[model samples]
Target: MPNSLSARTWVIAATGLAPLTWGSTYAVTTEFLPPDRPLFTGLVRALPAGLVLLGIARTLPRGQWWWRSAVLGLLNIGAFFPLLFFAAYRLPGGVAAVLNAGAPLFAAVFALVLLAERVSARTLLAGFAGVLGVALVVLRGDAHLDLLGVLAGAAGTASMSAGTVMTKRWGRPPCTSVLTMSGWQLTAGGVFLLPVALLVEGAPPALDGRAITGYLYLALVNTALAYWLWLRGIGRLPATSVSFLGLLSPLSATLIGWVALGQALTPLQIAGMVVAFGSTIVGQAVAGRRSPVRSVPVAARGGTGVTNEPVNGR
Candidate 1:
């Protein structure tokens, strides 16, 4: 068996996969999913995936978690999804992802205010590099980056940033696993979105076999599995550090664009990828090693341990 530290490394790596997989959202939405149905798509992705996870876990939220689930579900899933899909549809693939890369900056500020965590100078540098790198990788003179898309992306980032910090602060119920927490939020978000989707979209669009396959991929792999791992990591890692992993989404999207869509990466984009990747590593490395759970172990180098670390304190 692996030692504690080594095991934590694997967990962190696993956490990284969630966003990396999410990076393909733009291409997936444009090519595979029904267009102009952001709300419907969002509903399907969140509701069913959540139900599946809930069915497997068979765990329910108790007491205050009912509202907590609502709040988290709205921010992390409901609002974020519509805004994200709106941006994805309006902007070029790179543009939306580039806007999302702003999440770490927002997360850092939220951590400082809400959790009292300090943003280090190195991390600031990392943020700067990350932004610059994303700009280089995605911003193109010819791409029509819409104002509405930019706003939607910014809103999505802010929504998710707040949700992420809040999740880290509150932690999950003592008996709850990440899957249960994710299920609660997903279910709540889906519920919130259902009426909105029905009201705005008229009805869920018809789907053929290809669309069904796409929705299944999104529900099972992208939303359900992704959120479970992400929530798990949030409870175990510094919220700000976890936010930094989001930069990988754009990079992953870029690669998918290149391979699947036959989009070409310029030399500048390749250089930017290096800087973005490097900055993400440095930010996480300098952000310290542990998350702050309330009742976790002292030596449980694994992120699963509960901690008393200040929301803003080391």
Candidate 2:
């Protein structure tokens, strides 16, 4: 077994990778997938990938877990995915990303409402800063805004934020693994999309080799693998801390836009990135400071009886 320090380090690294992989979605969708049918693309990206993960896990959720999983899936994946794709297809990538940055702010509100979690001044400030950054990025030099796209993105972010808070509120059942929890959500989301995909998209498009590859990467790696890691991190870390880390998603998307897609960033966009990322870091730091410290029990370190440093100061 890895030591506590090593394990924590791995979790952070894995967390970072998840968002970075997510950042690639814009370029992948634009470059590879057939265009114009946003809902269809969302269906393909979610349902197939979800089924594969469910097969691998081979653990069906039981009792209350089923309902909980379904709710979470709808909010986090089913609704969020389709709306996100709609916004992405309709709006500029920078604008979409900026709108999605409202996730943290939504999360804060939902956390207070659902989980009764207190929001500190620091977190609130950070949330505002993040929103400002997003506005800066989206507004940029353009005078006109895509109202439909903005609404879609904001709705998607709200759905995801509610889901995140619900997950934290519900916590995980002792009998279920994070993989199983994730599988349930994916399966539910996929099932929800099946009819829509069939009706709206009709038959699957004739995919070229590159498109096929992109779909595979998105389904297997981005949805299944990344989601699994994310759930695990949520189990281990503070809810606010984990939510704050999501600010990186937009930042990563910005960088990926610049590097992979050869999209040029205006000065406003750069400023937005700094403010958004900086606020996230500050929020997490403040949240961490307020949380109580718990000593690491030696037995958790594989029974060596040598206590390791507390993970996340708890």
Candidate 3:
């Protein structure tokens, strides 16, 4: 119990930074990156960041890991980035963010189906509460939600959620650290995006100082550093619990708007923030409650040989 609590504490802190950094992406892209270049932006954010990590780690996928890495890369970074980029571009950033608030619910459902994880009703309620809270925080009566953007956001959430669950199930290779594993996924995702970015968006942006600064931050801190902690947290923590932390993305973005952009927050939005935070706390408690590990039968655990003399039942 003590060990689990200690681990959760650090995982929460590290994972929290990922969403906070991600919160800045919408603002940064609109302010500093080239306009209407979602594909190129996504590509730059993923591929270069990935290559840098690979250079640092100096590792390659081993045997079957090549395909495993590709699968994960496609789902988590390659496809996810493009889908998310489109959503952010087509809709208001807040609208895009509110749509993505469904990620934890998707994670919970996927874990339940694929991993045989038992999800509590409290977690489900928390997910619904999160959606409501995010709606309050991000949605406006005048906001026009785009259907394509909504679909893209839903698909992105689903992709990342499944990737998170699968990462937990597979863990990493023996003798490989989390950093190197991140390199494998990042590099694979970047490679996949290279041709697409060139075909769809042509040449890179004419990056001036502001654009350069923004790209550097995204590549280094948001992609490389953030994903390292996120993937590691998935490995150590419950998939649903980690997914719940994603709620902070919209919250941080809203807070940034309030402080940085001078966007006004009504009393309702403030109350919603409180509810959203409470939901995160409740969901984590429920998801983080440890279930006992199912022990392997003695025969499987290398007890005295019984296979040759298995006459009792058969």
- What is the lDDT of every predicted structure here? 0.82, 0.73, 0.78
**Model 2 — TM-score against the truth?**
0.85
Give me the runs in candidate 1 sitting further than 4 Å from their true place. Answer: 1-4, 90-93, 143-148, 289-314
Clashing pairs in 2: none
Winner on TM-score between 2 and 3 is: 3
For residue 233, model 3's alpha carbon misses the true position, in angstroms, by 0.3
Pick by lDDT: 2 or 3, better one: 3
Every candidate's CA RMSD: 3.7, 5.2, 6.4
| lDDT digits (tens) for residues 109-177 of candidate 3 | 998886667788898999999988988888878777799998998899899998988876666666677
lDDT at position 169, candidate 1 = 69
Q: lDDT at 271 for candidate 2?
A: 92
Worst 10 residues of 2 by lDDT: 301-310
Better of 1 and 2 by TM-score: 1
Q: Rank the candidates by TM-score, best first.
A: 1, 3, 2
Candidate 2 C-alpha lDDT tens digits along 1-314: 23644565565567667777887876787888777766766776777777777787788877787898899999989899888877876775357776777777788788677655677888888988987876666554554458898899899989988887787666665555677778888889888887877887788788899888888888888788888877776655556666777777777777887988887888888998889878877876675554432334434423222221224332
